[model samples]
Target: MSDSPSSWPDLATLRDRIDDIDRQLQVLINQRAECAQQVAQSKMAAEGDDTHFYRPEREAQVLRQIMERNQGPLSSEEIARLFREIMSSCLALERPIKVAYLGPEGTFTQQAALKHFGHGAISVPMTAIDEVFREVEAGAVDYGVVPVENSTEGVISHTLDSFMDSSLQICGEVVLRIHQHLMVGENSRPDKISTIYSHASSLAQCRKWLDAHYPHAERVAMPSNAEAARKVKGEWHSAAIAGDMAAELYGLTRLAEKIEDTPDNSTRFLIIGRQEVPPSGDDKTSLMVSMRNQPGALFEVLDPFHRHGVDMTRIESRPSHTGVWNYVFFIDFKGHTASSNVQQVLQDIGEKAADLKILGAYPRGVL
Candidate 1:
């Protein structure tokens, strides 16, 4: 069972090679840190502001460039993550941005939050979506991230509803591609897998695949995918449906990959903060309106956008809860609230609708 002498690596040579690689990495990391300091100095001088720091746009540009020019055995994603951690370390020389997201950890929302803030900022994972907003509203966290919508499914109604009552502003956004995986405990065999657990949405998304493969396995809905993974033990006849990252985070083995019903499933997340986002050039504004419960009343509400030639991206209605058949319409359009077209539309809609409220305008999440 022992390796042949010829098959073994030369220990002394390997050690020397490893030392050389380490030295190279150390030099590169230091150089990157120095550049970040220079960037900080320049930003300070240009803005003539001491308190202003952490450029989201510039960080985004750096990651975009890395993704564009990457020619790698490692993917654009892997390369970008490397730079993200590097920038995170560099940013730590200054103050850390505290961000909150819906979580108990190992959730997709947590991934979006981390992707947006990088590892530089302090990430606080909350149990509920409303908690994310509260942290940012209370100034306990500098910003918050929450899922706003999905590609296949519709908007996250709870998030949209929460915005109707909250005072926080949408400062930015990021879209993360959702890849679901089936994971089980290390000691569980594939044949022994029985019950599967996950969040309801996760279970629904993978229903067809699960029906085809594990038809007899009982499906259990849990609060979060991470919690579902946590519940699976080696002795139990159970496995959990989650993401690959969750599997790695919780020491679970992947039973399958990309097991969702659709290949392009993605979720859009919003960044909420106290300050308004100065136009990022490309942006979307969300609004809520309550129209009179009458015929063509909805058309009267939407007629302003058509007249102004503004692009309306999304429109959804929720029961106004004001007794018999009252409803509220949530709208997403292709311009920021600061733009003239958007401003005029708001002006017109204010005159037309029973009630209207501008949620927030922020950069559209490109990724």
Candidate 2:
């Protein structure tokens, strides 16, 4: 297991080469940052008082190119993350934008916002999903991030319903791998843990795992995984199922890791904003279609997508919240609103449906 005499010299040389590479990377990053500043100045001069520096489509295109061109010892995702943070920092130099997410500081939505926007942007915590929407609509924040769906559980109804009334657009999407860990405070002993705290979905996600492991523990549904992590800090015989961010924020000891019943559990979140993001070459469109109470309503609305050759990714139905309108269908399809096939589908559906609202046409998630 020991290195040969010949290998020792190569190891030292490799370390030195790494140092040289780091120096070159530093120079290139700073140059990029300076260029971003120049871009801001150019916009200010050209656009007069209505200067906007952040472009969701532009960033998405850059990241897509980064992934496409990657040839790496590091993974495409690994390299893309490095570029994402670099772009975030450069964007901050242009102008730091504020984002609000559903949180008490360490929730998954906050993690999604940071992942999508990068660490350079200011991310504020909101008490509820509706609050996040209100803040963005009122211009209290530049953007808001909210959970849309989970792989194990179905769609988030609150977020989908929010679209029914709000004017906010879907600027971007972030998919976070959700890892639920069993954790306890310093005062809690591993064997003595008798109760488990987690959000309702977290508890449901880990149901089978909990049955096999901590069968006797009482499972309590908290308002959030963060709130569960917060409460467990003061209780001796209590543990919480939460993600890494919450566990780290609370400084709790992890008793079990990746305890979700489903191995690849993840949640999708959306970036809600005022600006309509242009197509990133790769994109998806979300729409809310209201249909009157009539026979073949579903087939009539969806046939257009099939006829136009538009791929419908998801379709969920909700109550229209009115007596006259019986069905409110939320549809997500593959293509930008700008494309001919997509426009054709919209046009066909517009003639049949009671009302149609284009929620957003946004870049598909990069990471």
Candidate 3:
């Protein structure tokens, strides 16, 4: 809108300088990768084959430092994302990590996995959330990414329930900003759309939007939005409500973009793995505690957290499978389990609660 190609007098000089910088950047990146390889070799030599190269806390710390030291035209998030790819690529040189996510393909969970681990990680799609957990538990994949909650629709019960039965620890978390789109295949006409398909959650998220735009179109629920996109590919009178990844994967064009009722709709995903992450200075701990069906049991259990000065982030209650009226509380708070105050709170809760499980303490989502 402003600068013309011919108007820039120093364009050639700037281009040459950029070329030089690119070369230098390439050299430095390779140097960092070489150093990563050496680190991998040393770890393997000292600890044998079981040496885990992926450290969630370490990566979180590195990315935080990158953002802290950054002074550039690019925003902090943009710069951190660039470094995330570099770290992902370098880690791949040591050992390619396999991540399992809930999907047929092209779901937001898949996108979140890629965002957290980068394109360098090998992402395998699981047909269901439980399958993703199973894959990680069975050692088929190094980690699993599953949606825990959405900003618009509240918590994902399936993910929380899965944690109730699993021994896997949460190693990391990814927060993805969701932008729902109405898409249709080439064979479909926007004016002719008589039906819309999406996951129950996505449909709920876009309820008002769909009502205003396509009032008469029948809304059908699918197992997942990506599946919805796939089912509509050959339908001449159907559209799917999904994200950009699904639209591109199914070769559909967006009829309407960001169609969710909430502009700030986003999803938080938990990274489930076998390993426990260390303290990252800034971290969050999640717990599952069960209490007897007593009147003051709830307050008695939670009072310790308030007394200890530990910041509680979230708490969700589900039926305790062991008893008729008993409940299990899934609690999240700021601070590591290793910290003294957190340990004290846990001890107090342990004395009162029937059972308690420390799900994991993980680095807060960086990007």
Candidate 4:
């Protein structure tokens, strides 16, 4: 039976229904906020006045549960994001977290930070990745977010190197899908863009696209994409290849959208903090292993993971700071460090490796 306009509720009635739902949502949200407040009180009572209110594992679990149980018109990611904002607001009622990211603002690292911590968090921008680590280590910020690797451009070696010098633990991770855009200022002539600015990795990511479209344009690599966007704002004949955030921040118009060579380009960012994150059921642990410069050293290090049934997600070798010829392997694998098999694997690797540092075991990215 098809319902006609006369049988269906009028626009006014539909609006009234929406208003009623909104009111109910408001009440429920407040109730949730009150419960969060009570949680804060309980934590203070148990762990003194300086208690850490942010629980990465607990938040990850809650978000995962929300996504798993959601049966709605909204997508799982959308619902998870809504809950993320709610949790962020509730956490602010307890304690507002300050997060540092590699940026001069409008950088992807900043986007990743906001994506993970929500808009309620205070996000600070640092010029370099090491500065982000420094701020967190110095207690200037509660946490820091930095890019670890990109799907299109490969690993960020600077981030991995920073880990070697810092004691910050990876508390969480967030993966951002990279979508590069060709943006220009209002006065800029699209046909006369003589130079394009972007980070080296970004330039490389869009190499094929740029080669085909703007073959003669001079590609200048900048420190960050946001910086490139900023640089283009003053020049009429120059354009910038940046992300949506940067384009919006600088009021640049996108002449061309999604111009990356690869459609599935993405970057994985790590959340760094001072404290260890407890196990979330679905978690990944990152470790740095420095093996002796000997035959089968890599085999000995990786053999334990295979034997213990640990699934290795990634393995990247970086030049060891300790020696000229030596290399350190940055390994990421599924399973919490506290798990029996993971523990056994680590123990075995510890025996074989010259040095091993467990960066952290954090919940995998949820959105």
Candidate 3 lDDT tens digits, 192-213: 9999999999999999999999
- lDDT tens per residue, model 1, 167-200: 8877778889999998888767788877899988
* Reference-based TM-score, model 4: 0.98
Instruction: Give the residue spans of candidate 3 off by over 4 A.
Output: 1-9
Taken over the whole model, the C-alpha lDDT of each candidate is 0.83, 0.92, 0.94, 0.94
Structural RMSD, model 1:
5.9
**Residue 34, candidate 1: alpha-carbon lDDT:** 89
Cα lDDT of model 2 by residue, 303-322, tens digit: 99888899999999988877
Q: Which candidate tops TM-score?
A: 4
Q: Residue by residue across 1-367, what tens digits does model 4's lDDT show?
A: 4587668988999999999999999999999999999999999999995688999999999999999999989999999999999999999998899999999889999999999999989999999989999999999999999999999889999999999988889999999999999999887899999999999999999999999999999999999999999999989899999999999899999999999999999999999998888888999999999999999999998899899999999999999999999999999999999999999999999999999999999999998
Task: Please identify which of the two predictions, 3 or 4, would achieve the higher TM-score against the true structure.
Answer: 4
Model 2 regions more than 4 Å off: 1-9
TM-score of each: 0.82, 0.96, 0.97, 0.98
